[model samples]
Target: MKTTLVLAMTADGKIADVTKSPPTFGSDRDYAHMVEQILLADVVLVGSGTLLDGNESSEVREPDRALIQARIDRGQTPQPPQIICSRSGKIDPQLPFFSQPIERWLLTTKKGSLDWIERASFGRVLVCETADGSDIDWQAVKVKLAELGVENICFLGGSELAASLFAADFIDELWLTICPFIYGGSAAPSPVSGVGFTSDLAPRLRLLSVDRVEQELFLHYQVEKKSEDIPPT
Candidate 1:
């Protein structure tokens, strides 16, 4: 399976403001670009924080005709399912995300899945706990996604989830839109958060492309994987 992380950050590398609100700084062009990326994926994977932060829904509620036709031509669902990753499975049932038209799935630990087992909120509940039982095992999650025939994943994140996937070396590509503003607070979140990597252990990237649209710069990068990092079958 291929996973692509898509984010729009400030020039100073902040994905959100200090308040951690849903980013509204990106241009309309940037949003279109993000939707394009999402349309290419078989499913959209997002952290619980991102989903709950702004009461967001992953459904493409008003997709353009061209966008719908593109998916149909590719033999894909008009809108991909969204898989929410939450270690605690503590999502609020009242959140508007549960009422969206799109199919919903949950990626969480075994204990976390218990509350959702009898709920109709999610179409599928995947349990893949780490050895310590502290978090979702992303590697195992990857395998499960593969078994479910998820060949392409669009990861819409809130830093921590991005960090986990990067640490696991599961991210295959990145699409970053650098907005014109500079949000420089330490509390502001970046494209990747959590215990960050040192220079030696950092994942390398090969520049794929760059596009300038108005004041924003859209950057695409392919994550260079080491030989030993090949994913398990």
Candidate 2:
């Protein structure tokens, strides 16, 4: 499976503002570019906190009918499933993300709580776990996605999920849009957060391309994963 992480950050590498507002730095053009990538994906994976961030769902924009039809022509679903991952499964049922027409799936650990979710008929529940702890078994998740014919996945989650996926070396490509503003604060989150990597195990990026539109700069990189970077199967 090919996993890509897409996000926009401030000039100082802050994904959120000091007030922790939903990222509004990117321009409409950046959003249109993101939607186009989402249209090409087989599934969209996001964190539960991101889903409840008071914004509308990540469902593809209706204005892009031709893009949807392009996917259909390639034998892909018109609307891909949006998978939300939570270690504790504490998503609020009233969030607007759940009311969208696209399929919604919850990926969580076995010990996570999901009473409200199951009863709500939101979508399928995929419990991904490792024996060591409640952390997601990413390898298993990849296998399952493959089983479901998911060849390309777009990740639009928060920093923690981004860190987890990057740490596991599951992410293949990264698309980042750097806005002109600077939101410098300790509380502001970056593109990757959580227990970070040491020098030896850090993932290296091979820059593929760079594009600048006005003040925002878009960078595309391919993650170079060494043999040891991949966890043993």
lDDT of 2 by residue, 1-233 (tens): 89988888888999888777788888998998898889889999998778777445578767988999999999988988888888888877777776777887788887664564447545678887888757899999998888888999999878889889988889999999988998898988888889999988888887889999988899999988766344344
Model 1 worst lDDT run, 10 consecutive residues:
224-233
Report the Cα lDDT for residue 195, model 2: 90
18-76 per-residue lDDT for model 1 (tens digits): 98878899998998888888899999999998998867665665656588679989999
**Pairs that collide, model 1:** none
Instruction: Give all candidates' CA lDDT scores.
Output: 0.88, 0.84
Quote the positional error of residue 216 for candidate 1 in Å. Answer: 0.8
Point out where model 2 deviates above 4 Å.
113-120, 228-233
As a whole number from 0 to 100, the lDDT of residue 220 in candidate 2 is 97
Give each model a TM-score. 0.94, 0.93
Question: Worst lDDT window (10 residues) for model 2?
Answer: 113-122
Off by over 4 Å in 1: 228-233
